[model samples]
Target: MTIGVALIVGDTLRRRWHTDSPGTRGQEFPLLAAREQAARSTAADSTLASQLTLPEKPSIAVLPFQNMSGDPEQDYFADGIVEEITTALSRFPSLFVIARNSSFTYKGKSVDIKQVGRELGVRYVLEGGIRKAANQVRVTAQLIDAATGVHIWADRFEGELADIFRLQDDMSQRAVGAITPMVEHAEIERMKRKPTHRFDAYDFYLKGLASLNLQGSKDAADEALQMFYRAIDLDSGFASAYGNAAFCFVRRLVNAWMEDPKKEIVEAERLATRAVQYGSDDPVALTSGGFTLARLLGELEIGEQHLHRALELSPSYALAWTHRAWIRVFQGRPDEALPDLNRAMRLNPRDPLMPGYFSVMGMAHFVAGRYEEAASWCEKAIQVQPKFLPPLRTAAASYALAGNLQAAQTMMSSLMQLDPRRRISTLRELYPLQRNRDWELLTEGLRRAGLPD
Candidate 1:
């Protein structure tokens, strides 16, 4: 059997790259579209400020299966196997499965399993190859501990191609059953580390999400907005992209990164409206759209409704809890919001956005007039993500209200350096605090820090 060089393109869909040399194996390159590759590569390069903590739940990603048959046509079958397994694993709420789009980006690349674990922030990696001969197919898979490079399980399944779908399902179930107990047992001895595998719209959305999650600088935020826009271009009905794009605008507004707040707000409203309209069934989209409305557009009533619907759809959705907590703060119910925020942190203990969660927790404390506690939580958030703006501002306000003028001024300077335009006068307009007392307290603290009125 002679194997030649092959180039693989796309995630779920596979295309063959023919080489001039037919008999010898040549180096393989993932031939994803140029623009998509650029965006993904750029997103990957963004300096991660801190190592992301491993999720409390067992997180895993199934890499694209190798086409061992040496036939380009068999690439589709291998991809299908991974896709089916990933989807099957996602049904378990306890298992954090990296979405397919993010995972598939590693296809055709020779990556170290440990590095793959760090890049994706997953504790376990599942890798395998597929071989097809005549009417029969053989699938081999192994699960590895990314942190230690230890093999937890390995197995092979063989069946006729006519039963391909059933074979895939059976293989998935077997793999899941084997992994579940191992993960649960390993939970006691270990703690740590995950990415996605998938299509044009989804791939673009994942890239956009990655950019947004970095939240390192204003440029990253702008890039995320553009990526989400591209995702929407690829699929006009991609509600999650719209939701995320709207959330990007909200991020810009809060961070004081926007050059034109009014224009961005209008854009945010439009995107949020579209997300709510088209993604009624998607809990993540609904929650993001709802947060944009309530926090940025000040549409509390409608936002609350969307958030409630989102929670109904996904009771354990950590992000929905985060959004709902914000709404609770707006309604002048900080006490209620704090517990909800805590729940979010518990659900995703090692979430990349934990800093945001901590900062919001400080906001809840601030609203409740617990200035000292607020400052403590804000400082904790700042220690994790020094570049993040909200926590800095919250720290300043909390310090000021607690009568620590020097610390307050230092925090204020940090916030000003991050976004020079923020001031006491600006806070009233941009911040959505429905209670007059809440607004007054925030401004008074900022004014005490010597911000211009």
Candidate 2:
């Protein structure tokens, strides 16, 4: 197929650069425009962050598929379809998609189209509803104006459950075809809007939520709490945000930055349950709910199930994978957990939390007695975040396992400086393994690393 290059003109969508030489559809988008478009679009998105560096390519968020079937049980079927679509869309390496963590933040939210564009920093948004009965499924999807609250294109997909994958491909193709443009108007589509939505205070709350998820330090956590309060003042129905608020508190506890773990865990559970009640199928709510049940309530099986369901609904979801990976690592099958963490990294390579992913990968290898590989991965992790706990510990442990006591001691000293009291005991308590094998593997590593009993 012969393709020509054409530069898209401002205000009107057209070929950006016209050339006698053929260019792929992706190449047709001017590099500068694509970058600007992503920035403009994210500034429009209402997710948990501001202008994000995208994955391989720009990405759009597909929120939870609405359960239009009026049958509660069929909610699973709808969620499954969205999960499939999210997975398919992510396979393309060109778009930077908001991890489900940020995307699902809008689960119960009524948003301004421009705000969606601004917040997610994407050129488009794809959302739809599913109505299913017995074997019949009807799905409707639309690519919308994240800035103008306008629908650029819409399509309805109807078929039997057996043809689910086909429907997903069709939806992705339509969305990709409609939104993949190089240029249009000076504003593209993201316009600075004066939001006049239902909850004025909630707007600030959204801003705060975005800030907290930036995942840096205590300052971010404090900001998240403040935003949750603001959101509650505007709409108490914002139960989902409340769960997010509790999540911040739980982070404090788990990181040993808190005065009381038990008390904070209780509060986290309360908020998580409320979020679930308010919006059941929401991936965010499910994450919070699952953590509370498993980590706080010690309901291991149910917690695993909830976390599993969350991943099933949003395959490109990094946070869910993070939690799930930890669960597997603790269960003694670091081998099983490796893929989950790898998936998280691929979904958001620019994520500042790269250290965590590397750390876990190293630990998984270390526990499996792959000392050389563990040390290698930990070194890569330290390049990202020097003070990152898991990778630091893994480095020391890997060295010791390889019988390099001097090197192990050196790394241990650094780890101790970063965390004054290196507490293997605390890690066990916070992330108590549901499986005996996971517990044994990790603990055995701690012992090998010269962890004091």
Candidate 3:
């Protein structure tokens, strides 16, 4: 056997080294040519591998669920479940979720979790099976730590098939809600062991996000801006970095922290423009850029178009929905804004930006002439973030309009302590409400709450 194997290897080497055609002689050895071609292929593969390194944030891939209903027709239903789950997971900006097209390549295959992890460059994999019988459907999903092949979470969902869409939504929501927290916990543990010096542009971006999550802190916003700028310096084409930097200016404007208004507004516009130019498909970039354009630069029409495109790209992106609601409020369409705000809250029930959501809800109600409801929402926002300026101003105005003079006075006192320079005359300049009536209403309530002209 050894001798035969040696003869075969010798013959193979001879064929590879010799050119089959005499005309091709002295041009190149076949084996050397093959090796050169392989070298080029290997270089390309290495580049691809570098591009596929595990993302800085928690990343997950959802494989198509098996259709175990004994009917090939049920395949579509199983695929729908995976699609819904993928869309829901994509709503989370902190997660690096793989799209359905890439994940569906593993459909109907018995895959190795570790292989999926290596190929997809993801930390977690979600796989499951669906069974349908009569008017009912059952889904069994398990989330696995791709590197370790350990099951992190598993759940079974059973629902009526009469409303398949609702079932899909419910299942996806439940799965995502459970999976997100697990992934976050795993990421926290992973970060504890990761060396700080291994930082990349994405690491800087994540650090910026961490600072931004400390809502309503001027110091935190400043730190976040620095981190984002560092990320942009490292990766000049980073759309989200530019978008977030623009949003820091928006935060400054909202909180009256801008020391040089004209210069800051110009910088904000420049950053937002670059974000829109480079991030046509990135919902985070679109949301921040569009909001800044509308709210700060007064480019309402273009801003609304960008925001609409963002929603089309990511229907469940909570931040996009929230900003769209804010734009509606600015457009004097409070009735329309309320629904979008509600949708945003539903999509991200535990969002760190809940204070902003509540404040926007209050603004919508206040603009719609529901003073009591507005005050109620503003109070909720204040309770969550006691120093949040927008809610403080809105609460003061809403309370005064709702005939609660004492509460209005108390809120006005807090607002004054936060921004002693606040004056009724500056309200329109700061807010820039599109409708004269809305501006008049806001100023009147502030005046009644004892703000000076």
lDDT of each: 0.69, 0.59, 0.70
Q: All candidates: CA RMSD in angstroms?
A: 12.5, 19.1, 23.4
The model with the greater lDDT, 2 or 3, is: 3
Ten residues in sequence with the least summed lDDT for candidate 3: 1-10
Stretches of model 1 off by over 4 angstroms after superposition = 1-198
Per-candidate TM-score against the hidden true structure = 0.64, 0.57, 0.59
TM-score order of candidates, best first? 1, 3, 2
lDDT of 2 at 186: 27
lDDT of candidate 2 over 405-451, digit per residue (tens): 77777777877786665566766555556666645655565566666
Ordered list by lDDT, greatest first: 3, 1, 2
**Please, what are the lDDT tens digits per residue for candidate 3 over residues 243-278?**
888898898888887766776787788789988988
Clashing pairs in 3: none
TM-score of 2: 0.57
Q: Which of 1 and 3 is ahead in TM-score?
A: 1
* lDDT of the structure predicted as candidate 3: 0.70
- Which residue segments of model 2 deviate by more than 4 Å? 1-198, 292-298, 437-441, 447-450
